[model samples]
Target: MAHDSRTPSVPPVRTQKLRAAVSSRLWPIPVFAVAAAVALGVVLPALDQAYDERFPEVLQVYLFSGGASAARSVLEAISGSLITVTSLTFSLTVVTLQLASSQFSPRLLRTFTSDRFVHWTLALFLGTFSYSLTVLRSVRSGTDGGTEFVPDIAVTVAFLLAIASVIGLVLFLAHLTREIRVETMMRNVHTETAATIERVLARKPSPDTDAAAAAGSLSGPEALAAPDGQPVEAATSGFLTLIDEPGLAAVARDAGAVVRINACMGDSVIAGVPFATVWAGAGRFTAAELEDLSRRIGGTVTVGFERTNDQDPAFGFRQLADVGARALSPGTNDPTTAVHVIGHLSSLLCDLVERDLGDRTVQDSDGSVRAVLAGPGFGHFLSTAVSQIRHYGMQDVQVALRLLALFEEVSWCDRSGAQRHVLQAGLAELREGIGQHHYTSAEKQTLMERYQRAQAAVTAQRGRPIY
Candidate 1:
C-alpha cells in the first residue's frame, strides 16, 4: 500500500569509459610481451644476412687457414649441445602445460594439446633439417673447400634468439593470467556484498523505498508534493511526505502494511497510490518504530514523513510539539497536518465501505448482514453508544462489544503489538473518564453475564482449556 518509489539513476557514461581505460592498462602487458617475442624470433631472422655481410673479416678469422677444421669440430659440438638442450626444454614445457591444464581445466588441455601437436611435430622436422644443413656446410668446406658456400655467423645468433624469445613469452603469459584471476575474485566479493544488503532490506516493514532511502533521499527521484503549496512532512529532522487518495490510504494503513514494508526512500512509489509517511533517525530503530506507529493508528491512512535513509544526528526527528510550533509560524501556514491527512483518508475509506454495504436494514439471503455505520443509521447509533458508555464508566464494555462486532463481520484484523496497545490505551482513558470501579449493581450483573457468555463461546470454538 505504501510506495517506496525511488528512481535508479543511471551511472555516468564517463565512469564507464574510465573503468574501461583502467582495465585496458592492466591487461596490455601480455600483448606487448607477445609482440616483442614475435619481433625477436621472426623479424630478426630476415635481417641476419645484412649484419653478416658487414662482418666478413671477423668470419674469416674463425673460418680460414686450417682454423676451419677446429671451427668445424666446435660447430659440431655446439650444434649437438643446443639440439639436446632445446629438446629437453621443449619436453619440460609440454609437461608444465599438461600439469597446469589438468589443474585448471581438462577441456583446455585437450584443445592445447591438439593445437601444439602440429607445432611440436613441425619443430622436430626443422631440427632434422638444420642438422642436415650443418653436415652439408661441413662437407662443402672440408680441407681445401672455399668459404663461398659456408653457413654465416648470423644464422646461429638468430636461432638462439628465437628459442629465448619463446621462453620469455610463455613466462610473461603466466604472470598476466594470475593477475586476471585475482581481479575476478575481488569483483565477485563486491557483487555478493551488495546483493546481501538488498535481500535483508526486502523483508522488513516500512515503505519499500526504505531500501533506496538506505541508499539516498527520495528527492533524487519522484518526490512527493505536499498540499497547500508547502512541503508536507511529519518532522523536519529526517522525514518526507507522500500524498495520495484518501480511500487508498485507509486500506494501506489497515491491511497493506506488508506491501509498504518493502519500500524505502529512493525507491519506486508510484503516483496516484496512497501511503503512510514515517520518520526514522539513521538505523533500524527509526524503521522499526515507524512500523510500530502505523500499527497503533489502526485503520487510518497515515503519511509517514520520515527519513528515507540513515539520517544525520543534528537533523533527525524532534518531538511533535516542536513540529506543531513550526507549523504555526508566520512564514509557513501549511494547513497540511499529518493528523489531518490521516483523518481525511480514514473518512474517505469509511464512506466508500458504507456505500458498498448500503443501510443496516438490507439483509442477505443467507441471513448474513452488513451495517453502514458512518452516516445516519448505525453511525449515529454507535456515536451515541460511545458517549453513553463513557458517561457510565463502561469504556471497557464499549470497546469489547465493538471488537466483538467487528470480529463477527470482518475476516481478519492486524493484531500487532502497537495496534493492541493503542486499543488498550483507549479503554483505559474511557475508564478514567467515568471513574474506575463505580458501576451500579445492575450494571455489574449485566457485565458479568456478558463476560460468561463470551467465555463459553470462545471455549466452544477453541475446543480446549481457556487458559
Candidate 2:
C-alpha cells in the first residue's frame, strides 16, 4: 500500500474516548491532584527545615506556632476530619447521581459525572487528606528520640488545603443542587451537542451549491448497499460511539477500495454482525487482502458498553429526548419539564438547521471518496427530539402547544427546507395525534390555530439563517 506523509498509515489515537473518560469518570483528575499534593507535602517540609531560623519574625508568627506534638495533633485532626469530609462528599455525590438517575433520565448520569466542579471538589478533599498524612510523618517530638521539630510551612500548607476543601464541599452542594435541575441539564446538553454539531458539520450548503440532500438519504438498496462487496463484521457488540473516518479513509485510499460503514454513529451493533462492507473500486481483493483490510478497519472503529458524546452529536439528542420522554412518563407527569426539554430540543435543531447533515462521506487528501458512513441527518435529529415527546405529551395541552411553537421557532432557521419538511411531517403526525385526545372544543380550537400557524410557517416560510 502506498503511504504518504499526509496520510495516517495506522488508526489515530482514541483521544475522544480518553477525553470522555477523564471528564465522566471520578478518578483520572483526582489521581493527578493527589500526586501533586503528595509531592508538595514532601517539598514543603524540606523548605520548612531549611528556613526554620532564617524566617523573619513576622513570617514566623504566620507559620505554624505549634510544637512537634501539637503539629502532629493538628495534622492528625486535619487528616481524620478530611477523610470524614471526603466520605460525606462521595455520599452526597452518590445520592445526587441516584436522584438524577431515578428522577430524570439515566442518560443524565453522564452530565453529572462529567462535572469538573464535582471532580475538583473530590480532588481537593482527597488532596488535603493525603497532604496532611504526608506532613504528619515529618512531625517528631524531643521526648521520643530526636530534638523536637515541626515542619511549620508544611503544616501551614495542609491547613490551607483543609480550608480550601471546606469551601469546595460547601460549593459542591450548591452546584449539585443546580445541576439536578432540568433546565441546567438541558443547557449543558445543548452546549455540548452544539459543539459536536460545529465539529461534524461546518455550514449548510446553499440549495444550488449542494443538492446532495435533495436526493434525501440512502434508501432501500442504497441503504443496504455493497452489492459485490465483502462484509466487514463487527468485533464486539455495543453502541458505535466513535469512528475514525479519516484514518479509515486513509487505509481505504491506500487499498484502492471504498469502505461503507453499515452502522451509524450511536447505533448498536452485535458482534459478528456486518457493520460495514468494503468494495474494490479498482481491483479484486485477494482473501489475504480482505483479512488484512478487516484488521486495519477494526482499529479505526470503537464500540462501547454505552453511548458517549465523544464524536456522536446524536448522543446529545438522545439525552435531551430521554429527559423529555421521562418527564412525560405517566409516573412523573411533569409537563413543565417536558416543555423545557422541547425548548432545548428546538435550540439544538435550529442550530443544526444551518449545517450540512446526512450520510457523511470521508475522503483522502486527493479528494477520493474512501469511506461512506451512515449517520443521523437533520431528520433523524428532529425525529429523535420530537417523536417520543409528541407520543408522550400530546395529551398535555401545554406540551402540545409548546411543540407547535417549536415548529414555528425552527421555521426561522429552516432556510433550506430540509428541517421544515421533517417539521411538516411531524405537524401532520401531531394533528392526527391531537384528534384522538379528548380536549374541550375551546382547547382543541386553540391547538388547531397554533398548529395551522406553525404549519403555514413551516410549509411556506423559508427561514433566514440566524447564524
Cα deviation at 439, candidate 2, in Å, is 0.6
Model 1: per-residue Cα lDDT over 1-467, one tens digit each = 22222212222334433433333232243344334434443433344334536656756565223344544554465456545654554565466456434332222232233233324333432343354334335323444654433343434543453454355445535633542342222232223323322321222235454454444433221212222111112221222222122222333233322112222222233333322332222222244554455444322222233321111111111111122223233453332332222222222222222221111111122221111111122232123223332333233344334323321221112212222333234334443453455567776566555444433332333222122
Q: Which ten residues in a row have the lowest lDDT in candidate 2?
A: 1-10
TM value for model 1: 0.21
Shift of residue 193 alpha carbon in model 2, Å:
1.3
- What tens-digit string does per-residue lDDT give for candidate 2 at 1-467? 22222222333447666788799899888889899889988998888888889999988888989888789988999999999998998998899899889988898888888899988898898888898999898888888687787999999888888888888888888988898777888899899998777766657565553454333322112322446888888888999988877678778877878888988888999988788989886456888998899889988888888888776789898999999999889898899999999998898888888776666666555445567777677778888988999998999999999998888889877876767667778889988989989999899999998988887778774753222
Error of 1 at 42 (Å): 18
TM-score of each: 0.21, 0.91
Candidate 2 lDDT (Cα, 0 to 1) = 0.81
Clashes of 2: 0
The C-alpha RMSD in Å for every predicted model, in order, reads 29.2, 4.5
